[model samples]
Target: MTPDLHWTVTVDPLTLAIGFAHVQVEHTLGHHFSLYLGPSVKCFDGILEGANGPYVGVGVEAGVRGFFWGTAPAGGWVMVRGVLASLSTNVPNTATNLGGYTSALVGFTGIVGPGLVLSGGLGVSYFDYGVLEYGVHGLAPAAHTNVGWAF
Candidate 1:
């Protein structure tokens, strides 16, 4: 059989406008488990409250997927990922500042169709508020619907 190659694109509606995409190559282990890993990229562009200004950044992400549902290509799965990005903001009356955020998220994965995966879960995030000094750290709800294409 040919190797399995799939690409998935995901987005979060709660975080203004944050999205991610990745390409995964699936490797079947025995007859009931599958493992896939790939490089992912995430980006954001929107408004920022306070003196910090607009929020914008590009983060490189690494993700892993594990499927455990017999030989069926569509079923339940899980994912864990980490993201680190270089971020900056343009605050009026202030110099261009630099900051970044690191996040770790885990979610339950489900396949809805021929090539669709729906993942949703909760995660904790740490944000460094650049010049603001005071950062943010808390638990947040995360959800994403990804469409995959296998070939």
Candidate 2:
């Protein structure tokens, strides 16, 4: 079993900035099943204009790892995760009915080393407004790279 901690900063396709701090645990689940779970802090620029707000999120990823059509340090994997985020904004003159959003993410991560990894994926989010006739849809594309030092 290998455990790692990672910090990721993601910019949405519309230039909204988001950041995450996460912990991951990876291990072989028999032959082709691996699992990862972690909690994170999710922040968005559009929600706060430029300041980051805090929201709790969790995710699970499962896929196969190892070289399939290449050599060492190069492999393919697929992952899917869901996040529920909440933020408070001070922006006036707009509809203040929306305060939270739920997002679903699906992406792939490529192995780069025994201690380093790279991943990129896309996700869509929906915001709900109570008693309102309108909502917002958001699209986010993210990339992450992390290096770990085992102890």
CA RMSD, predictions in order: 5.6, 7.8
lDDT of each: 0.44, 0.36
Q: After superposition, how far is residue 31 of candidate 1 from its true place, in Å?
A: 7.1
State the lDDT of candidate 2 residue by residue for 49-79, as single tens digits. 2224322222322223332322222234444
lDDT for model 1: 0.44
Q: Per-residue lDDT of 26-129 in model 1, one digit per residue for the tens?
A: 44454434445444433332333321334344445455555553232344445555455444445556453444344444445455545455555555545543
Off by over 4 Å in 1: 1-53, 70-73, 92-136
Against the true structure, candidate 2 has what lDDT? 0.36
Off by over 4 Å in 2: 1-17, 43-74, 85-137, 149-151
